[model samples]
Target chain A: MNELVGLSIGSIRQRLVDCQLSTVELVDAYLSHISSQDRALGSFLHVDADGARAAARALDQRIQSGDDLPRLAGTVVAVKDNITVKGLPATAGSRILAGYDPPYDATVVARLRAAGVIIIGKTNLDEFAMGASTEQSAWHPTKNPRDPERVPGGSSGGSAAAVAAGMCTVALGSDTGGSIRQPAAFCGLVGVRPTYGSVSRYGLIAMASSMDVIGPLARSVADARQVLAAIAGYDPDDATTLPHVNLSARAGQTSLTGRRVGVPKEYVAGITDQEVRDSLSATVDRLGAAGAEVIEVSLPTTALAVPTYYVITPAEASSNLARYDGLRFGQPSDRTHGHGAASARLRGQLFGREPKRRITIGTFTLSAGYADRYYHAAQRVRTLIRQDFARVFDQVDLLLTPVAPTPAFPLGSVADPLAMYQQDIFLAAVSLAGLPAAAIPVPTSGQLPVGAQLIGRSGDDNLLLDVAEGLEQALPVSP
Target chain B: MSDTTPTVEHLTKLANLELPTDEQAALAAEFRRIIDFVDALRSAEVGEAQPTSQVTELENVYRADTVEPSVHARTLVETAPHQQGTYFRAPAVFGGQP
Candidate 1:
């Protein structure tokens, strides 16, 4: 069961095609493993054992009948609770949405289902994808699979933890600002923050509308790319999704020859941890050795990213989260008082601390007198930050940097919100630029796994994954 | 550019949220810190840079005017906490019985 659970998507597909593994058996292994292990990890919020078993049985019948199989046949995936999966509770890791089972699947979920991916359950996340750590989840924090005492980096921490611990073959996670990549980095998995609007956000619980993207977390770069290919494309429902976009990496292309890889000086200088800095240097060396030209590039606006992200994200979140008035599909409010009072009381009682704080900050920023100074100023600065990436992309094909300043820290160690926001110092800039970035684990010698981030030009998701795959092969094996 | 600290009461009211009295002071301080942190944007030399609300440069995506089948009203109303014959029930807006 452990060996079957540990198979990659590629191996699983091959074995399934060869009739060596049955879909029901694989799904049962995962369901049983999750049932026993997820208690300690807190990676899953809701397990759809019946749904998974039913899907697996149907797929097994299809395989037995020699019917044409879908691309991701027999692969089991865990979805972040924020992405709706019709009839499944889509909590976004908040108590406010406790009993709200969505009426329909998110666009990505629909696409994944069509491609033959069986969803095992809804994974946990930071409430509304707000915090750097899963500690802010209204239910429970996900422990890092690498070190159970530490948190799995979030808000996609549960997704990362699930994929890392072999609870599922791959997991879907939403990245507003480093939600996917940071968690993947901490959990030692390959996580992609696909180009903004690359994956449809039709049913994803909106965190920050502009920056929100649904991507994949998987054990391998190939698996992440395959999942991205299945979910990415123009969706009429999402006007922002780019038309005629190709998200698939060209097969058999792993060489980094002639690729210009830039090591951002700003990212390197901001790293206070010696181990993480050493890992970055080692990754740069590997990139150079793999026949890529490595250069030091400066993104001066990097320092402004976290501040800009915080401002823009909260502003959008306050507006997006306004819908949870309890009249609709969420925890109902006590109407004994009045409508206005009930609405306020419902939000106050159900919203997690981080969401409330962000709502307050957002409301304050977008208020009449302060909008120009805080909101608009941050937007203009956001433009500058995007320009910084644009300029650097002109000089280099990709930027190599550490995913976070440090690896997974002990749970509850970083208490102050200000210090917590600073974790995205390296991540938020790329997100602000709306470019494709992936976090792939590099070899770590007896230390907590540190991931190296690869940022690509907008719409260059294929190139980013191809390069990450190349680097993944070139980097030394972790002991 | 004056350091005008807005009170939490006013902000939460605008946000349609309420906090317990004991937590208000801590939230106020945290809000101030966040405000001060984002204040760094004021120092950026962003003269004439266009404010980017949406990253995708696409504008005004339009579909065919023909209406398509949408989610059934009954299905949506079923998810509501309170419903009465396909209509979602809500608290009274104007001081009256709901």
Candidate 2:
């Protein structure tokens, strides 16, 4: 069991093909580990032991029958609760969605199942994927496996923590403004936010639809590459998914001989931690040593990304979440009078502080008088942000920047709402630009992990993955 | 935009939220702070630049106008708090007099 839990997907596949490890044994190992160890971590909201056992037994039979196995065969994958699986309780980490079971599987979930991945459980996350930390989840907060006192950076905190703790091989997390990357950075894992519209968002609970992307959080770059390949492609259900989506990650170029990696000047300015700065410098030096030309490039609109994201996200969220009016789903409060009054009471009762705050901000900004001033202005600046990336990509193949201003801080330390929003300062812009970026942990001198993100042009996801693999090899993380 | 800093009452009314006095006061303060923070976008000169509402280049996607079976109406209403004959039940929109 100990050996089974620690093996990578690549290693597991080789063993499974050789009949050294049965699918049932793999599922039982992960389930037992979760049962004994997950109490303190609070990573999983619901562990589907019965369902996992049934699937594993079926896979074992197929393996015995000499049937060809799928790519993700015999691997355990944990999903963020927001992404629905058929008959699984998907609350999107909100009390407002309590007991709401999705009637069908999300496209990604269906894809994962089709590829022979056993979904172990639904994990915890920020309510509606709103907060930077998973502290906002109505259920218990997910603690960082590294240090239980600190937070596993969130809205995808549970998935990151589960992978970090060896509870699952690889987990799927939705990155809407750094939800996946931030937690991966904090937990010392490789997280990728694919090109917007590259992965189908048909089943992902909407949070800023334009920026929300479903991605993989895995312990190694190779595993992330496999998971991305299995799930990324055009889906008929999602019109936003790109038609010519390419799903390949090859390490054809071992050395970064011709790659020109950009280091954004703005990212280094306000980063006060010398340790974080040094870790980033070491990563760049390694890339340079590997023959990649690392140069300082400027994205002048970097500072405006956070504000623009906050404005645009909430504006869309306000419109998207308007459907939850205590009628079709969730429990409604009894406030006398008519439908209008009851919905008002219901939302007021069920919404968490962050959701209410965003709703208010959204309603205020998109108001008749202020719509042009705030919402339109933010969108126009979003255009400028995208232009900034487009112009910089012309000069360099990719940009290397710090994943966050700092590593995982102690949980409950950030109480102020605006301060919490600042956690994504370094990550939100990539989402705004609809670019592909990968976050890999750099071997830092300190105890906590610090990650550097590689940002590539839209549809250059394969290139970024290859680069991430190169960086991972250049500066291998210590266990 | 009001004379004295914007109150949660106005925003709540717009957002269809009902809050007690204390929570409203707290919400009002937080709202003021968030709005102030977002005001930083005013510095960027976005003159004549087109707004990018959607990042994906695809637009006006059309599918065949054919009917496909979907989740039954009963299945949809099964999760609702109150339902009557496969219909989601909600409080009356009009006032009690109706």
Candidate 3:
């Protein structure tokens, strides 16, 4: 059973194709593992046991008839609660969305099902994907598999934890301001945040629409690449999706030869631990030794990312979250006791502190009196940030940096909102530029897992994943 | 700082949110700090550079204007907090029953 859980997607596919492992047996193994293991981790919110069994039975029957299956056939995948699955609960880790199940699957979810992968369950997240720690989740915080006392980095914390704990073969997580990568780094996994619009966000409950990107967190870069291939592409329903993106194709280069990896000096300028810095420096050395030219590149506007991101994200979030008024699809307030505005206020009260804080700040920033000073000014600064990335990419193929300042902090230790917001300082700039980035685990000064971030220019997702794989082969950190 | 930052009550009204009175003071303080942090954007010399709303080069993406099947009204409306005879119920704008 442990061997089955440890098998790579490539080997699993080969075994499944050879008829050595029945789809039912594979599903049963994961289901049992999750049933026993997930309780202490708080990784999964709801398990689709019957649904998974039904799908497995059908796949088994098809296999018995000597039919060929897709590469992802018989694989079990977990979904973050924000991404909708038909008839499954997607709470987005908020009490406001209680009892609400999406009527349809997200574009990615539907595509995964079409490719023969079975979704085992939906994982937890920071409520509305707002905070860096899962402690903000209304339900419960997901504990790090490395140390139960520490938090799995969030809003995609549960997805990362599930992968680390071997609860599922792979998990899908949404990254808005390092939600996926930070958690991936903290938990010792590879988390990819694809280029904006590379994957459809049709059924994802929007937090910050422009920055919200759905990606994979997996045990290995190869597995993350396969999962990205399965879900990425254009969708008619999502006009923002790129017209044609072949995320599944393997990059031609296997080595770092002739590749220029930029070390962003500004990314490490702020307060960071010695251990995390040492790990990043060592990874840079490893890349250089592998024949890639390593050079220091500066993103001068990096300091503006947090202020700019906070402004725009909230400004967008306020608008996107307005649809969750008590009337249509959220925790309902009794209308007979009040007027429309009052009832709406009551419904909004269902949200946790982080979501409320964001909504308030977003509303205030976009308010009539302040829009020009806050929203417009921030948007202009955002342009400068994007231009900075473009300038650096002109010098190097990719940028290497630390995923976060430090490894996983103890649960509930970082309480202040501003302190919590600082957790994504190294990552938010990448999202601001709408570029592709991946977080790969490396040895840390402390026992906890620390990740090194690899960032690429817009639409360079395939190359970025390839480079991440190259680094993975060179650095070789145990998952 | 107090004059520039919106009070918790004022922000709650604008955002259509409600917070308990006991927690409002602390939340208000935090908001003030965050707003102060955001004030740093004023330092950037944006000049005549146009603000970017979306990064994609694609603009005005349009489909064929064809109607397609959507989620069933019954299924969709079921997610609402209150519904009566397939119609979503909302609080009345005026002081009366919805």
Candidate 4:
């Protein structure tokens, strides 16, 4: 409990401001920790010690100057590899972009740096944020900090593991269908998947453009909020971003009293884990006791989220990933032994199996003759799923459900792809609805951490965080 | 008729991936399994629900064709593995042309 590594991001910033520690000292400590610890955990694709230290020094000077520093001043944060940091290798955890560097920092990265947030380094992820676990990362699989044998959850697996292992104060993760929250669940961290476009997508390599949302994974809900506050808001480059609003409630102001919380009956219907269901039920009861009115609601199309998302996401991904044709970024191989064919061979050898596989699946799904049969049909179903959530929201201010059907399953048990896809069932619907949801670690209730997902109305990001703070206090932190 | 047996090869080509025989077989099986699992959606009844392309009601936004600043060529080519006069060069690929 006295561990600074495991302390909340808010506390870490306070310590720095109180002159108890310097940003450079914090970076040095974490760099030493990463150098010693990251090999076993496989968290970062690259740990930029020199860059981080330089930034830390600059931040230290700012703190010393006693200028108006953002609340997250001197906090260490890790960025998912997909989000570009100028001069850093933006690999998106794929060999296709093994050492690609962007000319400019992603808007969010620039914002964090402006706020005096020290970017520790780039964390590993699914190849193009495509897989269910970091096992699919091009270079290495990020192991669960809790238990190395099990996955940290993905495609933001490394970011979650970084926070869980006390490697960073906060980490930025993108959720396109539970990528952020699921890993947070696995690693016992607070993961918030803000409403789509709440955070700028200007620098993030596109996975599913529509569903991709940037959020924070941290040691506590408050820590997540601090990082979110720094990064959340609009960038003119990303037209989807909402203008930044000062959300007071996100700092744990709003009460649960009279807040209509809905328990979607269909969510827990097929889930076999009695304990997971009981935990969610108990969360609802806890909220009710916290003075919020909890009601039972049904979303019949909830089960269809994964299917619809898989279709729609791959369609967009196919187009987005097409830019990596070996001409602009990454290593370009000889393409004309006889023609442009030889370079294709060289390029083919450079990318790993997963990146190649996803690009192919996306292409095939969006191809002629199959486009309507697959992508269009999925969109129609996505409509029903969206309407289902909208209908529920009309009756309730927030919806409660399990972040996942069960706690972290053993890593290797999900060998079957369909079973792995099924795991995102509870999450894809919220992504489809483009709603803000917070997954706060309810407790280790048992072996692994389980989180009760609080999905709020569109743009209700502040309210979602408020509910998360309430849940954080109501729920026991077994970690 | 598209044969599912070629799904692996097609996907590999489409994704610009070279899969070993073992991985090819694995991907084929996995793709088939997922496609089969979600195939049930095709049979579902949709009364009058129109195909929804995007969930958010926002319009497709665009800037007024304004010229934004771009990086200098030096910075752009800073990370390139090979560079020649005002261009990035690599191992030659063309046999007849080059």
Q: Go through the candidates in order and give each one's DockQ.
A: 0.81, 0.71, 0.71, 0.44
Question: Candidate 3: lDDT of A229?
Answer: 91
lDDT by residue for model 4 over A175-215, one digit each (tens)? Answer: 99899999988788889998777788998999889889888
* Candidate 1 chain A, run of 10 with poorest lDDT: A244-253
In model 4 chain A, the worst 10-residue window by lDDT is A335-344
Where does model 2 exceed 4 Å of error? Answer: B1-6
- lDDT per model, in order? 0.90, 0.90, 0.88, 0.79
- Per-candidate Cα RMSD to the true structure, in Å, reads 1.2, 1.5, 1.4, 2.6
What's the TM-score of each model vs. the native? 0.98, 0.98, 0.98, 0.93
Task: Decide which is better by TM-score, 1 or 3.
Answer: 1
Candidate with maximal TM-score: 1
Candidate 3, residues A190-210, lDDT tens digits: the string is 999999999999989999998
Provide interface RMSD per model, one decimal.
1.1, 1.7, 1.7, 3.3
**lDDT string, candidate 2, A1-479, tens digits:** 37788778888877889999998999899988998889999999989999999999999999999999888888799999999888889988999899898888888989989998999999999999998789999888999998899999999999999999999999999998999999999999999999998999998999789999999999998899889988899988999999889978445465687799999899889588887899999998999999999999999999999999999999988888888898887776473678888888888888888888898899988988788878999999999999999999999999999998888999889999999999989999999989999999998889999999999999988889988998999998886
- lDDT of each residue in A128-171, candidate 1, tens digit only: 99998899999999999889999999999999999999999999
- C-alpha positional error of residue B93 in candidate 4 after TM-score superposition, expressed in Å: 9.5
Q: Give Cα distance to truth, residue A349, candidate 1, Å.
A: 0.6
- Ten-residue segment with the worst summed lDDT in candidate 1 chain B? B1-10
- Of 1 and 3, the candidate ranking higher by DockQ: 1
